[model samples]
Target: MEPMRRTVWGMLAALFLATAVTVTGCSVTTEDPSYIPPAPLPPLEQLEKAPLADPKNFSSGGDVLSFITADRTISCSLTSARGEHVNLPYEQNGYSDAANNKLPIVPVAHCGLVTYQPPQPGDVKDDCAGTHLGYLGGVALLAPDTARYGECRSGVTPMEAAYGPGGTKAGPLTQLTVLADGQNLERNGLRCSAYNGGVACGNVSAGVGFFISPERYELVPAPAISSASPQAEGPKTP
Candidate 1:
């Protein structure tokens, strides 16, 4: 009887161990609490196919073109290196060419939102000192060559102000042409589309760009494209 009891206990222990091992192996895993996934890329294909904006909606000065959305909530300046160098407001102060000097003349698409929530503390870099960390308005810069697409310390409000005539931040708003919805502007390898949500701009060659609105902003990095993949073609200027 004692031997039989010992065998029974041993079998029960083995079964318990096996069950425990099976449960451990099949346990569900959870994502790391500290891990944050990247935002999804915008519909680049759709934006690329948008119809061209009316010429009257955009004002071109040689290589630089300036336009505002129909709602006047967002404005953009697209600059190409082809023509004479145009001094852009964001390029004037608090920006360094060292980060973007690789190309002889890189195309740039810079946009500003009239109203936007400031970036979170983690998103705000320590580069800006004394001045407020983030501003009520948000700005995005897409220099495809450098893969740069994000907000900088130089507030967009100041840029908007400078957009006024005579380089004054208080310059009249008439300087910027209005881009209606479902229309896009393409120039200097850069393209911008205005939608009901906001504006999307990108460097067609590099496959990088940004989407900005009053609620939030997203930076698009160049996607890895296999040779077999169909590329999104950049729009031509009208």
Candidate 2:
């Protein structure tokens, strides 16, 4: 009877140990090893608000208002489609289609660089077959609203030749006003801002814009807006 009693106590001890191990295993948890965090947002999206550009930094002419960066690296001009001069160059340049007999003069914001490197052959899509690819002329934000990075010129223009070391001197940007850093100018539904890094310009309502610097260029698309908020309207000429 004494041996049987000892055997029963040993069996009880074994049951208790098994239960403790099961409970401990249930409490242990392991994190997912394959999980990855999302990338951060671009710096431009983080800007709280954009202030109106200083009036002194821009000059308003017949149908265009032009401004230059403080460093004189970039120059931009805003043209209104409704302005009288819009038809002059389009007609003289013979952009008018013979069938329509009229060319659409779009409200546009265009920028030119005093100096920049030409993108590698495959870097950007080149529409210009015979013409020299122009990079220093920079980018343009059209009111019909698309951002274009390079231009095709008939020949190597002054700005195109001005790329290599100690290149040709840039001429006066048509005596344009200076748009200093941290300031922005808006006209005919287009806006351009200057920063320490580079210049960003685009059609505000459409959310289409571009960023240009001596080193690189990027086309920025409009961010998604919540349905609860009002939709931004398209460009309207004043």
Candidate 3:
């Protein structure tokens, strides 16, 4: 295996040494052997700007979420629920149909990445880094794919690497973006997806902040609610 350099980072999304590999969901369209690997991306600037204290504080840079590339814009406030994430991989909270509520049931169902989330132990649970990656910030690093496509979803297939605009690959946490939206957020111009030739994964994908694994946080039972009211008399109303 060879290592990538710095200059090769930014140019990746535009080059041509790309190849069309089949994945789970999205099928391959083209095959470009001319795909050339680009330079490496730079490190995320931790302190270049301060974290906006207010929740309303966002980059005036337009409707953008975290961890996406500079080209497109990621929506705001990524759903903490993985299932809702755009690029798939996140876990979706099962929705149910109402009976006679008359409140026209809001047609619902996790369409894309609104399916699954990283687990903790016996089951999958989103808890990035096992410790609360700082309620928001943490040392940026690429997440790697631990499983395959079909392994995650049954009918839903995993979309293989889409070698296009960005010359990246699809493996693990090769790219970084908001845990909420499946945007191609870039860091230092380095994106693992670009290496997969602009590959956008479906089904199973492990990349930077790909999940809220227990490896980062410890799972415990929910705190029980104590009753404040006094106990009623036994068999009174009967």
Candidate 4:
């Protein structure tokens, strides 16, 4: 009886030990790995707001005169591509109050520009552009406004010359705009010879240049851009 009792006790002890081992060795299976959540991102703040984002829509600054005379140009602050903060976006407009060459502020005949209309396709020519604006003055040419004998010669003009921010190699723009008014300043269209002759009529003037937006604009630093140039990765991989 004593031996049987010892055997039974031993069997119970062995069973308890096995159960404990099994529980300790067991692992839980889960679709997700043991997780530690990432820290949250910072909130975004408003950067910039410009009412004149569109030029054609023309809430403001549609033309040089209107832009220059305007009492104030509004803009907003913003973050840049490279993590810089800007106070005013309109600064991108590059509106300068600097005195221009003092040409009569006659309503810009055509706010748009004129390029030497290249000669015909088959025409022999070394230059893709017509005679330079400089030479146009000396050449006798019918006036677009008057059809009268050559009065104003055109080609490369003063606007093409350098001043202020210097100038682009391209010729200076003339009349940088076209106005509805002709010989006179009026809301109505002009009565230039072209208008009467049933031909296309546009005004011409000189000293036009492109304007940068005054709105807050961001630019990537040159170094980062240079580093990421096309050759940055070497030859293309198949």
Candidate 5:
């Protein structure tokens, strides 16, 4: 009976020991060798607005004339001869003014040498009636409002000489100067003036010249100075 009891206790102890070992072996723990968390993104900010200029006081100088073909969609800035900063984005009705009523956007007529006819001194006023402005051989000619015979002379010879063989190309112009009432000014060897309701330009010596007005724009042949053919000369005093 004692031997049997001892054998039973020994069997129970061995079973418990085996059970403990199996439980310990079955349980497992593992750590990842290459796992990492993602980094956070940077914060965003709102953009600032551009500063604006005063519309009422924006009419700064330099003949602030707009071209007849000026594109309103294209924004730009220009300085006038008066040294004023005129912003084009703010301009309305072609004129960059508060009232926007001063300057008129009239179509400009660009005429070449072949199409132009030199006006006889006596018929200048009548011939240039509907004309606005004209250019020949790279020289800018103005139509006369009145036939001032002696005043109508070729301003091209001097201009062609000053600005090279073909005269200065008009492609580089950005702004046209508004001649003060009856004012005449010289620039780049050419003199421009407003006369008898017509705007005109010529060689300093009054040799070759052109005239035009707001209502008229034609590239008439610049009047010849002398009855004889024009001499290839530099600017002379008008």
Candidate 6:
């Protein structure tokens, strides 16, 4: 009887030990309380396409005038004076609903260049490089002549290239004035400003700025197409 009792006790101990190990294994495999997944980044596929603007959108002086914003976030499309379709990509933010108390849609136009300041203080020249379009002295201008556009150290997304490390910030421009001679204009509820060298227009609320050089890019007040006169009745004979 004593041997039988000893054997039974040994078996009970083994079962208890196995049960404890099983519970311990489950505790170790439980999910972590403090683990958090990182936020996903934006996929900038638009950067892969060829750049849209060349020398301030209106480099060639023409009868029809139109301007294109370099901002990547705002969609810009209009028929050129030559009847060519022009479109630029843009990003929109915020909400329009008043009940939600959300902010209105603020559109920030993304330029196509990376602007860098000089390493030393008081350097007259800035190392503006990254893309064809660059910001200099509070103005965004063409930089391929002054600096190589694709030589920047950063990756070439419109946002990363324009405002990445060592890049310069855009100028503070408020109010929009119409560039047409003596006539002010508004488009899509935004104002515009016209100057001798270029027409500058920006919406502070939307965080957008558009600059067209030589004032010829103005699209409004375009020349009307004349009606075709009726063909002579005698021309239809075979």
| TM-scores of the models, in the order given | 0.57, 0.56, 0.22, 0.17, 0.22, 0.20
The reply for model 2, stretches above 4 Å from the true place, is: 1-48, 54-57, 80-101, 120-126, 129-137, 154-174, 222-238
- Write model 4 residue lDDT over 143-208, tens digit each, in one string: 112211111234332222311125452321221222121111111121111111111111222111
Kindly provide the TM-score of model 5 when superposed on the true structure, using C-alpha atoms.
0.22
- Per-candidate count of clashing residue pairs (backbone under 3 Å): 3, 0, 77, 28, 29, 12
Residue-by-residue lDDT tens digits, candidate 5, 39-70 = 42110000011122232232324432222111
> Poorest 10 consecutive residues of model 4 by lDDT?
42-51
Instruction: Itemize residue pairs with steric clashes in candidate 2.
Output: none
Q: Relative to the unseen true structure, what is the C-alpha lDDT of residue 146 in candidate 6, on a scale of 0 to 100?
A: 19
Highest-scoring model, lDDT: 1
Off by over 4 Å in 6: 1-104, 107-184, 187-189, 202-238
lDDT of 1 by residue, 75-171 (tens): 7887653222323543453133454445366677777666776665644434445565433337666665533323434434654555433445444
Worst 10 residues of 6 by lDDT: 78-87
Q: What lDDT score goes with residue 67 in model 4?
A: 13
Q: Give the lDDT ranking, best first.
A: 1, 2, 5, 6, 3, 4
Which candidate's TM-score is highest? 1
**Candidate 3 lDDT, tens digit per residue, 1-238?**
1345555663674353243222234454787899887652311221111222221332222222233222222111221122222222222223222333333322111112212233333433334456533222111112221211112332321211222234244532234342222223222222222111112211121122222111231112223457788879688685
Of the candidates numbered 3 and 6, which has the greater lDDT value?
A: 6
Error of 4 at 51 (Å): 22
Q: For every candidate structure, what is the RMSD over all alpha carbons to the true structure, in angstroms?
A: 18.1, 17.0, 22.3, 26.5, 30.4, 20.2
- In candidate 6, what are the lDDT values of residues 6-33, reduced to their tens digit? 9999999999988998988755477889
